[model samples]
Target: LAKTKPIKRFNSPLRKAAALFKELHANNGSKIIARSTTQDRMTKSAEYFLAGFFGLEWPTNVTLLLAIEDSTGVWNNSLAGYYNCNNSNNYRSAGGNNATIEWYETYLADATARLQKLAPGFGWTPKDSYDAQSLCAYETVAYGYSQFCGLFTYEEWQGYEYSIDIQFAGNNAFQSPTGRAVGIGYVQEVLARLQHHTIDSPIAQINVTLDNNTATFPLDQSLNFDFSHDTNIMSILTAFGFTQFAQFLPSDRIVPHELVVSHLEPFAARLDIEIINAPAPVKASRNNTDLYEEGKATKYIHFILNQRTIPLHRSFPDCEERDDGWCELDIFLAVQSKSFEISQYDWACNGDYEAVPYGEVTNGVPTQTSS
Candidate 1:
């Protein structure tokens, strides 16, 4: 079954994270010059944004949101967009002579050991100062990309730290601050333990206890889990209650199938998903499969949720039809109309689904507000 090769397209991990945030902005200081303050910026081109794909889709969230705003932030001329770039033919970094040019420090040591074993089973909380072989980048300023924290778990929250900026223009002060826990990627002790289980007490019977405004479903009600994108993905969506909820759909009523199980992914860094158990692509069979009576199924909205048990492995019993081994493990998320307290730039979801102005949700904490 030896096939796995497909990686090259300027070699990717986002072209080595756009050549390591453009060679850490070429060893320091002033290149700053962004302006974008929102305005449909580029107008779609590049062949109408490449019309869907298995080919030519490498924008890696628009080059990691312009590499967190130009190697380190600034430029919102109402949103012309700018997050650092030198892209030598597509991503060049220190200009490359190539000897392993820091390729994002080996992808920040595999994105910091999968952010420390899948962030404490998806509720995060670990950070003895980051090290599963740590190396995460980004922490800029001049008004672009200086976010520094809470990207999925890990939350020190002070505009999320790590904004080194070599000297002011917008975020102020610089020239060797070297702060942000030594050049960003502070890992804020990875977070996500959003256990609001709404106190039915016994942890809600079979472990159902989610509340940021409720969610402990088996389908009979309760469901709006976005705890502003954290608190452990709102406690694993209050214990796994959605295979779909991208908010404002834009494609077919939006349904997709495929649910093959038996994973636990490569076990150290995990992540080997995608179910639909094969009316097509098969192989990997997670230890000979049967992940609950053979995987693969589709048409989501099913429940029994418990997500991220160290990538534990085994789940398919919950059923709702299409059980050829259950499929639909694509997971999904697209919400960028712009908000995040008015700057992380609403995550740019040009893909579809709605909810981009993320301001209001107060008590629940979706507050990116303050603009």
Candidate 2:
């Protein structure tokens, strides 16, 4: 019973996320569509966000959406699709578990042995090491400091952090070559909503259609909110071909300077995609001189990961070689649609690795070819 007390805070990171949302969508009267996995913490996360964004107490007018955590159920649960899918190529069926276990043993073996010797009778197992790290995080946030924190030195803590990264790399992100399949449904939904079309994937089973109806799906809403687990977020990022989250093995020695899960999947991580309207560039020729003019404004989409702008790789046809990863709205929809067309829910979830390689950006746009 290490977690004997509940951790409660009004000004948690979730509140900060709400503050950011309010700042970005101020005075717009935006209705939020909050969704989360069927976990208590995830559902409460949605509630906390509503309170902060609306500045209201409990029982606010906001509605929190939840679906059964099953891939094949009538309800839409893309978060759990990896677990429920019968795909032999999926993480569970693949070497995901073994890879993680192997990495843990390789990296944490010496430190765990030292911990067992330090705390005799504790019988430090891999689970205990993970729990100790979890307790350090929980108690640090909940009570400002944890006794478990004192058990490991600074280097051991770093190793512990790397251990979590290995677990995520092996079990979630790029678990197999087709590991990104788990998030295809969500990606499809994003494109469908942007295009104002009904969801085409049977795995999503989303009842609402993007028809400018504020009651169900609002096409004009300035912001949309979804609360999900770390794995789901990772899967979504991978589906977008974010190379930063690629799997790293123990042999890679990618520690101390690699992707740290603590920062990526912290207490309250956010993934934001902003749609902005801006004037299009117009090229004009006058008197043998080329003049560039700003044309009628059009919409564009950019991604924000943890409050930082994520540069879109230039392979996407619409993604120019600019620092800002803004892609024309129509082009973004078109690029994402390629993924939707190739994603076979049954095949992807059922371990058909040969169906089609996951699509990636190419020649400034997404192509059928896989990267």
Best by TM-score: 2
lDDT of 2 at 361: 18
Give the per-residue lDDT of model 1 (tens digit) for 188-214. Answer: 101111112232322111121221222
Q: Write down the TM-score of every candidate.
A: 0.18, 0.74
What value does the lDDT take at residue 113 in candidate 2? Answer: 88
Each candidate's lDDT (Cα)? Answer: 0.22, 0.56
RMSD of each predicted structure: 22.9, 9.3
Question: Which numbered prediction scores highest in lDDT against the true structure?
Answer: 2
lDDT of 1 at 310: 21
Cα lDDT of model 2 by residue, 268-299, tens digit: 88887876554444232234333335676566
